[model samples]
Target: MEEVEIEPLGADEARDILAVAQDRRNGTRWSVALALGLRQCEALGLRWKYVDLKRGTIRVFWQIKHQRYRHGCKDPHACGERLHRYPCPKDCPKARRTSGRKHVCIKEGQKFCAPDCTKHAPSCPERVGGWTFVKPKGKSKRTVMIPPPLIPLLKQHQEAQQAERQAAGEAWQDYGLVWCHTDGRPIDAGQDWDEWKELLRLADVDKDARVHDARHTAATLLIEQGVDISVVQGILGHSQLTTTKRYTHITATLSNEAAARMGRALWG
Candidate 1:
């Protein structure tokens, strides 16, 4: 429903973004941002098992479900945008329980409910535990080849992470994510934006270019360089060719030049 922004970075600006990302100590995320065009959420959810450095390919299947901000819904009918709209009240007294026993709200200004979800006709997933990682959009899965130049950078980063893990020993939480904190837990997607904005500012590029525009940059650059449309579509994991079209931005000068070149070859 929302129109996609046409904000592909030129080669120079792309280089600058990568340069600044390295300067800012976020080389891995920025490299993936430009090279593979991964959404920040997808990048954050990546596990080490999905990354094949030997083969220069990365698997994309899951994304971290963002759930820190909003809680359960007051609306009884609507499930709300988030599934964790309703939460099990851990501190409420017996007065709030679905059971005949009494309950009290120890924590104020927060909705509380018990696990006895029979209050709703069919019940809801919110009645379950909190939200965690979720499948990719439409559950679409794809493998993307890493850029040739980025393989070595990834190797170096992995070595550094290995050292960090060794140092942390026992304290490290091994989530097996490709990119994580010193504790080995996945990076928070919500926190990714702050670094991205700083990177854009340092690069001196248009600040309005959303982090998602990096994905568009990848898609558009590959197409302009004459890769087959089907291959581009597959790389983008787009179910509809039309969706790929939204991501592609063909400049008028390039289009006219292409037309003239074809005419010259055919007639002259």
Candidate 2:
């Protein structure tokens, strides 16, 4: 198979990004995304039951998607096709880039197919439903250990969420996600793009960075910390050892050190 070159931020950049997000609203969620190599969907799907604060572990067993919830937008700024929480802007064009099978462009708010742009357009799902959460690309599911610091932050978040729930009373939706809207609804992935880009811009990081890069960030950091490749493979739940190999981006010093270690092992 051809090699897949993964792009993770330099350690400094990653640290800066995490620092910037540390106190932000979705800070814990973003931290987990980088620390545990979770796909956005996996993070979205997380529930309280899956987390074990006492044990310092969390389960990764399901993904979340809010399907078929439609908002009928009106003209002048209309998404006439009923939408889920993340509806496309009325001005969204029919022709746009397809970022995986979700079809709707989170950055551009453009629907996968142009409005009546194709003969099969009527048959397309985006015309009726909303974006679907997918698994980590071409990989199976696996759990990874959480960083020690994040565990307490998670506990604090849960406490804060409980306070919010009490404040809202009957208004809280109780979807039980670790990452969710203030009212306990699923976060709209399409709507998050604007804020994500803005976060990157404010941090002086690449404004064009995709959120999926967090998975790459976690994987690369693991390799840098001297974790075994086979362990990373299991953490990432890759179908093949080679699939996990694609995520390893080593620094020159580390590469040189690896060579030296091998040489010592051979000569000494």
Candidate 3:
């Protein structure tokens, strides 16, 4: 495992990197992935179905697995770390009344009261009216609430995606997001990461920065801006507060600020 470090990128460097992706026409997904500290799989697994635009809430579920359905894995220790699927809720807000797929319907007030529903597997529909949530076997699950600063960008990106879909016209199959390769296929995680790093290099950033450091960057910024450590911990989805604290680096700027504050308090 790579040791985590507090590697801070200059704002100009960050901006340049983001611009490169935009210039290349790689959607905001890459930038958003960096901004939100989302894992590669989590970002790749992102779909229109999970995004709640009106409320500005993005559901952090679903995992793109390598092979086999991890939902049924019995390993108690390994299960939580494994990728799992996010089944559509019968009462999901995103669900719409589509004539095509019954499972895709988001009918309001209409309970999925079918005698046997396809969503609830194994058990007969007669026994269960509907599924409240998917029960994927996982214990090491991590979920982080996004910061307020990132919410507006998410909304803007959603609108941009809609515009792109409209422009695509008949060719639009609604890949739900623009993170995938040109063909709408899932990009290989490692290769995609390498490409992003190369983009960063072209933008004049240090070659040593890892894609995962963005999470650290977000948390570090919060701390430097005087946000409470506990709040940063919650936003970073760290199981322990110590993990969150590790990302924060007290810079010379902070030290100077503290000295100036003390001087004013003592002199003034």
Candidate 4:
């Protein structure tokens, strides 16, 4: 496998981002991601039942995944124009970069799709495309200890959510998610990403930082604090120590500390 780039926020940068995120509705969600190194799906799928405020632990059992729609109609070709697949239009704006399965209808070659061509499962009358909670694969389902400082934030978030629920009244559709929309609906992953970008912008941090980088930040921070590599692996729910090591990056402080330790040992 190709090496993955690991760019993590510094301590000050993380503080800035958290301080900005505090005013957002799902602020605690970001906090949990940073503190626990949770995958985006795990954090979004987290439910109140899995969170033990008294025990200060969170069981990461579920992940919110967007499953692709499949054709449920008996006669896909007979489906409406919206359901029929089409080749790239002559004036297609995305033609320059389109390729593979996303570009042209595989069955139609380079020609325009037949009027009865069966395609675009997403538009089928009985389509089934949406987000649903599913079990996390492998060791990702392990439990994580919540940091002491984050406990109060979680409580405050819960109280705020209760207020939102009351305001929503009959509109609320509780799925027991620790973080959700004001109406208790599951938050779309796209929306979650947008919020992360907005938080970075507000915090004046790296504008190009990806949301998953928060997990990298958590791993790096743990290693910097002298946490054992195996312990960090367990906390991150990684199946292998090598995977956990990949998420950690060496910082100037770590280098300086290593040099200082070497100098002290050698001189003494």
TM-score of each: 0.71, 0.69, 0.60, 0.78
Candidate 4 lDDT, tens digit per residue, 1-268? Answer: 2128878889889989999988888898999888888988889989999999999999998998888877688866566554344667766666655444455433434543475565667778797766688997777779889999999999999999999999999999989899999999988889999999999999999658888989888898888998999999888888877887764446777888988999999996
**Top TM-score hit:** 4
Preferred candidate (TM-score higher): 3 or 4: 4
lDDT of 1 by residue, 109-186 (tens): 554334433344224544443326778876257998988888888888888889999999999987777778787876
Order of candidate numbers by lDDT, starting with the best: 4, 1, 2, 3
Q: List the residue pairs that clash in candidate 3.
A: 80-139, 95-106, 96-106
**Residue 82 accuracy (lDDT) in model 1:** 28
Q: Considering summed lDDT, which 10 consecutive residues are worst modelled in model 2?
A: 71-80
**Best candidate according to lDDT:** 4
**CA lDDT of each prediction against the hidden true structure:** 0.71, 0.69, 0.57, 0.83
Q: lDDT of candidate 1?
A: 0.71
lDDT of each residue in 1-268, candidate 3, tens digit only: 2245567665566678777876454546656665555555666657667766556556666645343222232332233322223435766766554755544443445443343323323232223222122322332144455546656666666566567666767766544543554434455668767887888778888658776765555556567677788876655556677776675544555667788999999997
Q: TM-score ranking from best to worst? A: 4, 1, 2, 3
In model 1, the runs with Cα more than 4 Å from the true position are 1-3, 68-131, 247-249, 259-268
